[model samples]
Target: MLRYLFLTVTTLAIVGCSNEQPQALGTLEWDRINARAIASEAIVEIYAAEGDQLEKGQQILKLDTLLQQAKVAQLEANVSVAQWQLEKLRAGYRTERVTAAEAALNAATSDRVTKDRTYQRQLELRAKNLNSQNDVDSADNRYQSSVANEKKASEELHALRAGYRTEEIEQAQAQLTAADAALRYGKLLLSRYIVTAERAGRLDSLPFKLGDKPPTSAIISTLLAGDTPWARVYLPEPWLSQVAIGDEVSIKIDGRETTLNGRIRYIASQASFTPYYAMAEDNRARLSYIAEIDLLDSDAQTLPVGIPLQMVKP
Candidate 1:
């Protein structure tokens, strides 16, 4: 009879120790969130409102892009001019230009020949005492000047017929490349004027209205990603040692018919008092560590933020 009583007592102790009931007390939260603007500009248009569901890369707001657009336009014109210059260099001199250069060279040569003959005649006349030494000297100077001019015109004509030099064409190509890069950079800057969602999520708020200028570091809106919903639960000092990261737990949400499964993603290293204003000092002093639980099911993401959740030992 005493053995039977001992067995009953042992069974009761085992059952009581094995079962740990969980209390419902946590709020749904977002682990992935988007906030703040990449740059500062006056708000021009608001494409999204509070509580609007948005897809990744969806346009959220537009900043005043008048100046940016104008800058892009100017860069585009510069690129066009650079391209035309490069093409002109590649095409070399036109047929008409070559012909004109050749004609100038011929004229210069004829002038030089005429001046040489006149100088020779002047020298012969001076030798015979028919002209003064000053006349011969003046004619010689004119002949020398014509010779220099003729050489210059000949070189110009040769250059025109030979086409542009390799170095000249390369320099023009470099200028065109620089212009293209500048245009691309200008367009990239202009794209920043339109704010888009970085990920799929629901927009929470827009702090500024249209025409309001916000600082670059200021948050324009807050977004909560529509993935696995995380729950922030407080574990009392007594339960702190029992919880750890990666431990699975059963979650029951208030007003929900089904329970969800989750894993412990984080546990605060330090304990703090629960922020309960209405509670007495003694109750608030009860230290609890904040533990974050990530819901495992994709369907559970539909749970709204701020909804209460309960954690149970599985």
Candidate 2:
């Protein structure tokens, strides 16, 4: 009876210890970054191959930029034209144009004086019966037309001397500004044809071959980004309260003899169905919360993703 009691007590104690430190099972993962095509352009050149390490701003591949370059050139020309127009408006009329307008006013004034003198002589002749009524009417019409022409010429000269209106200058300036903005946008769009790494990472894939044209927004490259892989584990519902973000834990890999250190970076707020790898006979029916633990050791950087690992409770 004494031996039976000792064996039973030992078995219970072992079971209690196992329940206190349940292992959370999961796979290693790295943050993935996908570079997408901005346009349906043929891949002309590839600077980096798959499995190569890339730094931020490093060229990965080049797409056909002929079309985009042409567009940018057109925009640049438009900007130049707009700039010239604005400058012309701001500078007002040229010296030669002002001189012509002044000359026109003077000629109109001289013609009006001649017409006035002719009309007065016709009126005096009609009053003395030397000229007919028709002659006086014709003379009056000529004089009035000349006066209108002179007034028009004077206004034209005045306008030339007054320079451009405030509204006209502002409109020209706005056109130039719009053209410049369009040019800047075109240049930016052109740069997108050359694929470059936005972050330092390992180039995991090149989805398109050289000379292949990809659809717009299609994935052109995939990168495994981050300095180290993180442990993506599922915590059993029962143990969810025991662990929290910022808590340090031990990471055990399948073939690695030494364990790695990790910190809990995130834990899902809701519970989910237990994944196959994390499901055990006792916890098969229980839901689990997804958690991500960032590997703290620099050596973990070399670890491949999707390798099964266990999170040992601290």
Candidate 3:
């Protein structure tokens, strides 16, 4: 009992003497968007550069859109033409198409009547033995062929007067759909001429200026990271019991006192081996839980990335 009591007292004394204060740390940076791909037309304007501040949705560039404007007008005309054609089909084939078919049928019928009269005369001649059997057969075949031609021409007229068949209309409608999609795609390409600032931040590493051409998918610039700089600090076993998220703590920065509001964003469920960077005499053979904290900063521009920071706990 005496040995156990001594061990308990020593552990409590060690815990009571431990310090939980903010360690001076460096700043952090935010990730960047690699936006590229400008309009292939003439480069019109470039509005941003390195170290320049930007607001959300601010226009950053422009390109010549003369050809694209003309193309948009042309697409509109095509839409009108397609709609007119569809209307004509819906109203049935035009009178002119039907008229042409009727004319052809009349010609066929006239030819058939003439051939039939010739066949009748040839039959009479064969009966009287004045004509050969081959002559009568030839006349009969010509009359039959003329009759078939007349039937074909009549059927053609019927089809034309019936308007577009369902299948034909469907095909035309499909073509219209394809044309609409193409026009939309062309407009999208046209809009790519202008790029904008998506977030509010300082810019860095901007490469292009007015009239400079950049390649597709190139990283020309970055929004220098700021706003409540964050750090992933490791929590050792000694302070495990004393810490939780959202605990208010005081930190020292460049000899100035600063307070940070921390919330436990995440906690690892299981810990394996300790990382190499966390190795030391007191920290050796120990595993740690990571805590992400947002540090407060007054100047938006001064915070750089990858700064060491210490977290304080109440």
Candidate 4:
């Protein structure tokens, strides 16, 4: 009976200790941000170097923009021309142009009248045998030519006063719309030439120096974020089952005297072998769930990544 009582007490103690123990163990880590080249262009200048601290949206590098600038300029010119054409179509012919066309028609009409009167005189002379048939024929040809000229001039005046055709106006409008869209696209392409940091962080690595033309697939630089570092830990199955996300815990940085408080931010749904940092003889063969702890105190910022830390479950 004494033996049975001792076993029951020991079982209770083991269960109680398991409840208070940390669920996972891992090293501190920070999220890395990468500045990648999004355009295929030659690098013109690098405003930043490795280890440079940068704010969000800061210019990290600039690609050669001469070609892009030229393209945009050309597109702008096209847009201007299209706009002028559309405006001219909408406004119709100018008053001065209409007046000129009318004057041309009137001059042609007067010439036609003079030619017709001369041809009639030649016909009367031919009938009296005072003029040869060849003279009548020449006058007749001149009259006919002048009549064609008058008709041509009259058509020109009619066209000038009638304004642009509906189809022509619509075509001009479409051209203007197309030109505007092309200009916008050219400007958008130019914007990609200036490479900017997507987040506030330290410039971790720059693969290319100034004047280097790197491939578009190459990462321009990697950024170590400025946020507080979090602990990346792996918990054995036993501890994994005991801890929940948002639970408060104590983190003691290895070789540090102070302990930091933090909350569990993540718990892996799948289990894997214990990572190298967390491996020990006792847990070497164990499957552990990965977990993350967000340090609550400012001390986390002072700590570097890969540092060992101990977490105590509260």
**Best lDDT among the predictions, by candidate number:** 2
Better of 1 and 3 by lDDT: 1
The residue ranges of model 4 lying beyond 4 angstroms of the native Cα positions read 1-23, 94-97, 100-159, 165-171, 235-240, 268-290, 308-314
Which of the predicted structures, 3 or 4, would earn the higher TM-score when compared with the native? 3
Q: Estimate each model's TM-score.
A: 0.68, 0.85, 0.67, 0.64
Per-candidate RMSD, Å:
9.5, 6.0, 7.7, 8.1
Q: Per-residue lDDT for 1-314 in model 1, tens only?
A: 99999999999976775563424267888854545655677998999998999999999998888877898999999999999988988898999999999899999999999999999999999999999999999999999999999999999998988889999989989998999999999898788778788888888778899999999878887888856788888776667667779998888887878888899988899877665631243365556778898889887877788887767743
Which 10-residue window in model 3 sums to the lowest lDDT?
Answer: 20-29
Misplaced by over 4 Å in model 1 are 1-27, 31-40, 94-96, 126-135, 163-165, 231-247, 250-260, 264-293, 306-314
For model 3, residues 127-189, the per-residue Cα lDDT tens digits are 999999999999999999999999999999999988789887787787778778878887887
Model 3, residue pairs in steric clash: 23-310, 25-308, 25-309, 26-307, 26-308, 245-264, 246-262, 246-263
Instruction: State each model's CA lDDT, in order.
Output: 0.83, 0.91, 0.68, 0.84
Q: Which 10-residue window in model 4 sums to the lowest lDDT?
A: 17-26
Clashes of 1: 0
Model 4: residue 204 alpha-carbon error in angstroms: 1.9
Candidate 4 lDDT over 97-159, as tens digits, reads 999999999999999999999999999999999999999999999999999999999999999
